[model samples]
Target: MYTTRNSSSSCTQGGFNLGVMHIGAPACGMNAAVRSFVRNCIYRGDTVYGIHDGIDGLVEGNIQEMTWAEVTGWVGQGGAFLGTKRTLPEKHLDQVAARLREYKLHSLMIVGGFEAYHALLQMYEARGKYPEFCIPMVVIPSTISNNVPGSDFSLGCDTALNEITEICDRIRQSAQGTKRRVFVVETMGGYCGYLATLAGLAGGADAAYIFEEQFGIQELQLDVYHMAAKMAEGVQRGLVLRNEKANENYTTDFIFRVYSEEGKGIFSCRKNVLGHMQQGGSPSVFDRNMGTKMAAKAVTWLTDQMLAHRREDGSVFCDEASTAVLLGLQRRSYVFQPVIELKCQTDWDRRIPLNQWWLKLRPLLRILAKHEAAYHEEGITVKEVEEALD
Candidate 1:
């Protein structure tokens, strides 16, 4: 934050004054990401300010320059150490611009979910209205949902998937001990189904319901039949995972009851909603490393752009790097995508990216789960059914 800290020149003498903040819901690896950002920025001769919260906090002027020792032992830490909120920047754009001017932040880095992304986006769109918002900015996709635009993977998605998979393992153990039983587990992903679909792939669940691919009574009936078939085939236990918002009419308990009624003589059903527990716990090693790498890349990218665009008058020229961007891991490479460019990729109604890369994987999960598809029935086009999915 370094807000109101003796004006911009004091901190800008040696390097640019950069600000980092955690926004939106807390997730594992957030602290780690901030730690890396602070360390990397300082290491590169730049002063890093820790914005206490999201855009709302900026208006309150709760910002401070961070020291390397302050982030000591934050590698595997989880949650928002600097605090966070879900406030968008639309209403407080003027206040945010004032803080940016006061803090003298040459660049800003936000680490959080879609809430943070959208909030920053409001400012990005208003760069012409507020000259202070012209500096380079970037978001490190940190949501467990993995639904942020331009990113194939988000920071905490893997950790949340691991948590869901582990819980599914324990549930499966209980169901296996009591043979011919099915467990309906619900995971949190808001409207996104990345967590549910990935958990299914990792835990070998027989079924995983996601919002991206709509499911209804017919799908539920097919799922029930699949569970019964698994039981009749002498399978010890069955597992089903549903994203919290997978379907409006179908819920975890609803599916459980349906299964219980259909498998009256064959099996029993139990339902477990894994609420906020998935958002807690230390981030996985993969997340810690990924956070470190992504933070380093973001800081480096921002500084490089600022310097390249810096001029004799001390004002940086706007360029590709000056635009607000999201640092996302796409395929094998890490790419920086402009935040404004993501508008078309976003489903504003759902607050998730449109045509998600992982949505295509949902049908594969359904196929692997062995759901009763047209291929298993007569007079139903298998290709049409397959095409209908995802």
Candidate 2:
């Protein structure tokens, strides 16, 4: 086992208290993160607290110190064991600061979606007013949506993708038994289409509709005609995956109706709106390892920041420019990007990253699905593939 405490820091190190909380929706790898964080802190002779139900729980003093044994066997668990809520800490920002002070935490670790990023940023901005908000607060992107900025990959996304792929397999099997059937499946990604695009590739979907790539009625009809062409060519099963919030006008049901009407005697149509089941299941192995490594790195990094900024008076020096950050994976390297620095890369209204890596892979998805669009002659090289996954 790797030593939890870093012995090479330039600054004198001592015991510290760190708190962890889960914010936003429940995710598959969250429990693994919590376990790794608690174990890392305990091994370093530091106190770790589990803040229940996010900022609301923090305001209510629902936090309790975590034990090493409590987190043992949490690696494979799904969803958040610490509980979570999407409630942003805007209104309760003061209460959040007060709780941090009361807990005497040296740093804070947040696990969960874009909302967690927003909440941490709010506290970071208010650090000038409240010293309690000045600690090294870090967010580990754990949402299945994979929408958080500063990160190429979020924690729960792989598991969610696997779930969607398995469900699509089952749906396709049902379609295969038919003479000709076209299925329109809706996936969850808020306004982002990362899941739909990738799932389309994995499930052999003929077309994928995403918010990043706008599609009107004409485009939908064009896709229907293409599906008909494929059916005419003896293709029996057709799959079209669409992001849940891809467009206000083009809904899953509407697409199903359009496909049904256009296909007529050519094929049958079915629609499946995958509900919360996408968020439920044992975390995939990739997610478990990702969460564990991210948590271990975050704990170590936060400690270094805390010790590096420790003032003579024992209070941590609050540096607004570098205090709250997100631990995002950049091409397999652990990047601790300041949350404030992510504003330009973030779509605040949509709660998605402005530069989506998966969007670059859409052309590849289309080409593989035989969509009538010519892509760059380079045809997505291996280097580009690795870079895109970054």
Query: Which residue pairs in candidate 2 have backbone atoms (N, alpha carbon, C) closer than 3 angstroms, thus clashing?
Result: none
What TM-score would every model get versus the actual structure? 0.90, 0.93
lDDT of 2 by residue, 335-381 (tens): 88888889888888888888976787776676677764423333656
Query: Model 2, which residues run further than 4 Å from truth?
Result: 1-7, 10-14, 373-390
The per-candidate count of clashes, in order, stands at: 2, 0
User: In model 1, which runs have C-alpha deviations exceeding 4 angstroms?
Assistant: 1-13, 313-322, 372-390
Cα RMSD, model 2: 3.5
lDDT of 1 by residue, 62-123 (tens): 98889999999898888889999988889998898899889888888999999878877887
- Worst lDDT run of 10 residues, candidate 2, spans 1-10
Q: Residue 138 in candidate 2 has what lDDT?
A: 90
Each prediction's Cα lDDT score? Answer: 0.81, 0.86
